[model samples]
Target: MTTARGDSPADETGGLTRVLVADDQALVRAGFVALLDAQDDIEVVGEADNGEEAVRLTRQLIPDVVLMDIRMPILDGLGATRTIAGEPGLAGVRVVILTTFELDEYVFEALRSGATGFLVKHTEPADLLRAIRVVAAGDALLSPGVTRRLVAQFASHAKQPASGADLAELTDRERDVMTLVAEGLTNAEIAGRLYLSPATARTHVSRILLKLGARDRTQLVVIAYESGLVRPGWQ
Candidate 1:
């Protein structure tokens, strides 16, 4: 993807989050660039018209976060996300998918492909900005309520049964943390429920991720469901 200059002034010196917007629609890209550029802590660094370009610009410009639209001309957002997430050099970069349908099938695939989270196109600007910041700060953006419904809707259709052996490496406390994580509890919520310090809860979550070889909280949720660590419609 070729880099297009943004309307806002550059603020790389201010420790701002650099962002790249990728969408097939010019209007959508322009609107996102304008909204994100207005923020004090965010700078719209570049824009791309397709997934292939998005991937190229990601490697070239190395922006902190990518606002990626799922459908595009050449390559799709899922393909681009896979490329970005698979590269060790681009590990610092994150992707938040843009989709029109809230429960689009591609959304699940996007998450599996390494996208941190997704937002429907009609999402409030404030929420959109928040999602960008959340992903950029190294956190996944799946809300608990939405995650539960999504997972419940899809989990039963999974071809493989949940596996107990996959979680053999985790200690009992780490398993508890993983269950809460799969339930979409933030570290603070997990800390409160388990009577642990937030820092301790965070550490537990980190250890769980490391042990499971998961990329982020979303993957942890997937594991919780797929490994039968947590199930739908059961307390």
Candidate 2:
């Protein structure tokens, strides 16, 4: 639930984003570092050749986001994700899983294992930068199929099936926000859809989190789909 400094408005900040790239291959790690360092607003803080080293670097640097590969030596990405996620006093950190194949089973396991977002190795620079920012801002970068599928699958498996769930008590408006959030709409998109200002949309999102006692959009997504506020395969 706690936020870090980089989440502030982009105008005042100058250093862009600081990131850590963790993968097993030396070539892959180098490529990621080069790509991120190319951006004026993004920086590669460090690189890890294995999952264990990733865990160590994460605790030491606490970058805005960790770009983790699914397969790695010394400890697979899922195990490292669990370690980073379970680490004491590092809840502010966000993990993004990296993969070459979208349908790879490890992608789903990475999510369940604790990644905040995910992307393919061939992701465009613009999208990759945006993903990092989304995670840094405490939002999950769920791009439809990749994120929604897992969300839907997880929701269907829950006991309550999500409808009529108390949400521990959020207002109807807050609940609406949660649904769109699960649908993976950004604040601007949500605002446009709801006919509200961007700032208003942001406020609604924040309030929804507070009301639901949820940490971020990812948790909100879990709540909405699980509670049947939003059923998967909906038109």
Best prediction by lDDT: 1
How high a TM-score does candidate 1 get? 0.89
Looking at model 2, the pairs that clash are 162-226, 162-227, 163-227
Candidate 2: Cα lDDT at 23 = 84
In TM-score terms, which candidate is top? Answer: 1
Model 1 per-residue lDDT at 142: 49
Over the stretch 67-125, how does candidate 2's per-residue lDDT look in tens digits? Answer: 99989888889899878876656677788899998756577666655578789999997
Candidate 2 least-lDDT 10 residues = 1-10
